[model samples]
Target: MARELRGHDLQCAIAQAAAVIGDWWSLLIVREVTRGHHRFEELLAELGISRKVLAERLRHLTDHQVLERRPYQTGPERHEYVLTGTGRALAPVLISMQDWADRWLLADGSLTGTAEPDSAEAARVHALRGTPVPAPLLLPATLPPGDGRAPGAASRPLDVVADARATVLFAYPATGVPAPLPPSWGSLPGAVGCTLENRLFRDAEPSLTAEGVAVHGVSTQRPDEQETFAAGEGLTFPLLSDMDAQFAAALRLPTFRAGQTLRLKRLILVVDASRVIRDVIYPVLDIPAAVEEAGRMAMKVVEGP
Candidate 1:
């Protein structure tokens, strides 16, 4: 029988491998990076790790050449760390960790959103090591332009992006004056977007079909450029880009009041084939409106036209 790596042993292959990545945090850092987390603030926000620990982990990973630092901009000149080839090799390791944890961590850590599938189904998520995962199946469903003669008919769908994939969609809405939702609300949309997108991806393959892709536009180069992009760094998916207003106008979403700024209304689209949006979800304060609609829309999209 093959023995396990142990203390004071340097000859075993496992021992050698352990020397490089025996630390738990190292693996986590790898996981986050693989999930498209690139900036310092983004990582801290996701894992809630202390600054000292985060700094140390990043330094260690970089020192070992698991990540490569690149210059994304020159104005304020911040640095982003991308995965090195060695780091890319951890995909299997992280996949296995998530798979194992799904079985063991469910009772202890269900982490808010959708429930994990039963063990039988989840095991299938593992055997796919042989097949390439498909992209989210996005359909070009756009809302029909309301007649200019209408009074209060809801316009169309708002912005959509894959959070981790699109805030983090490639990351929402309201009326008059224009207010960014509270911190709590602002915070959740990103995670929820990430979760929903991931849920769909997990359920099937690429082909991330969504209402529309607006958040993708907002993530380009931080309209509010600052010392930290926390949720504004690089996005996992490509947003609609610089044209978020187009969605807001089409949807006739209400105006929000963030002090005095006029922000785009939060709208969720349900599109049909040929890019004709079928349903529209106005700005929601919580998850229910979006959730129920998204659930229905996903079924429709997955089932076809």
Candidate 2:
């Protein structure tokens, strides 16, 4: 039986939340759901949990309103579990925990986003090559004003690159733009080349566009900050903000803390119109080379065999 928080503990948000999701199976269930595993069998296969335990956890989550069941099949009356608003709101918490584990437990407690080429982190990112990006994942975009669009608009990876043959989505730590970066930013490993990476992509935008390739940059920065930077830099492509870290959590992307916020590591993904990740470039050693490689991969995707 699960223990319930009461009295003074019930008044604390942390304690209350822990009481609901503190169980090991309960939290992993949420993580798996966020990763697009919806059906009972899918969760069971991914979690390797016993069927009886899985059923119990699913029922507990539904009773707590963290997860809701929707009928996915008729006649047989089968249902799939999905996150409720309360559960979806836990994205940041999951991402923060990942960041903590990556920094402290996995690595040497370094505050760097880039990883060694042969490192486990790099291997994990490389394994995403054949994975399908979730279609429903959308991030806020920093669009220019009066562009025939609303002031604050959200965009999905597929929708942004819908018209193009392929897309090069690059994730950077943060750019020193409308707002100044932390004083220690310059000294942090893998934190230096974001501005340059954006510039390189900006310079390559015209050619990439002509080749039916769309380019977009992503970071945890606010949309307004990205807007200011995009305008000032004369960037033709959009910069998406993962401010809530939903994108990070969905992909299990690596992150590090700086300036009191979680920032994505520098990496690139070549995604086709079908939302399949064709290639992944991590620990971006050279900014110029990575940009060139992105273009090459995008073109390769366009000129498929």
Candidate 3:
């Protein structure tokens, strides 16, 4: 149960927020739900929590408007828990915790975003191979002019991968386009290859399209910044701006702070047409090799079993 705060504690916003989600069980509940484990049994198996405890936590979260129950079946009257707007807003909190843990708990307390191939952060990313992406998740795209929509339009991952057999989605820190990168970007471990990665993908686009695969580049840069970069680079694909960190938080992607903002570490995801993550490439040691590997994995997914 959450602790009841008194007058002075009530005056602190942090205290109020913590009161709602300070419990270990409550925070784990939010994490599971954010990972798309909404059904009771799914949450139960994932969390390994007792039925009574799970029920109590779920009721507590729902009461606080963090989760809402929606009917998914009748007769027996089955329902699933989904995050409310308020709950969705907790993404940054979850991501911040993950970033902190990855940096301090898992690895040496370095400010770098990239990890070694054998690091715990790499293992966590590889474990996402079988995870299903949330169906309704969308990020604002930096579409080219005359696409029949206004600038900075939102694009769903499902829609982007719908017409293709597989889509190779790569995330980078940032690019030097309409604006210059942070001064320390060059010295950052994994931040050196954004422009190179984009160029490689741009050149590989035609062959990938021929193979029934699509490509998308994602970064924490704003839409205007991405738009300028896309045009200057003559990119053949879309550059989605996760300025709000929504996409990063949804996937729990590794991130590091740069220029007073969160930037995604270099990684790749090969998602199948069914919106399931088929393969994950993390700690991208070699930019060209990573792009080549993405193409290969995407083709393999297209080939099927």
| TM-score winner | 3
TM-scores, one per candidate: 0.38, 0.93, 0.94
Question: Please, what is the whole-model Cα lDDT of each candidate in the order they appear?
Answer: 0.42, 0.86, 0.86
Order the candidates by TM-score, highest first.
3, 2, 1
Give the Cα error of residue 273 in candidate 2, in Å.
1.8
Ten-residue stretch with the least lDDT total in model 2: 154-163
Tens-place lDDT digits, model 1, residues 1-305: 11355776767766765656667777777766765567888888978899899888888788778888888889999887777878766654554444345435533432211223343323332232222111222222222223242422322333343322211121132211122334443432322343343233223222343433222322111122210221233233332322222222222222222322233333344433333344443333344445455546545644564
Q: lDDT tens digits, residues 93-173, model 2?
A: 999998888778878887786888987788888988988777677777776445676544554332333457898999999
| Model 2 TM-score on a 0 to 1 scale | 0.93
Candidate 1 lands at a TM-score of 0.38
State which candidate, 1 or 2, has the greater TM-score.
2
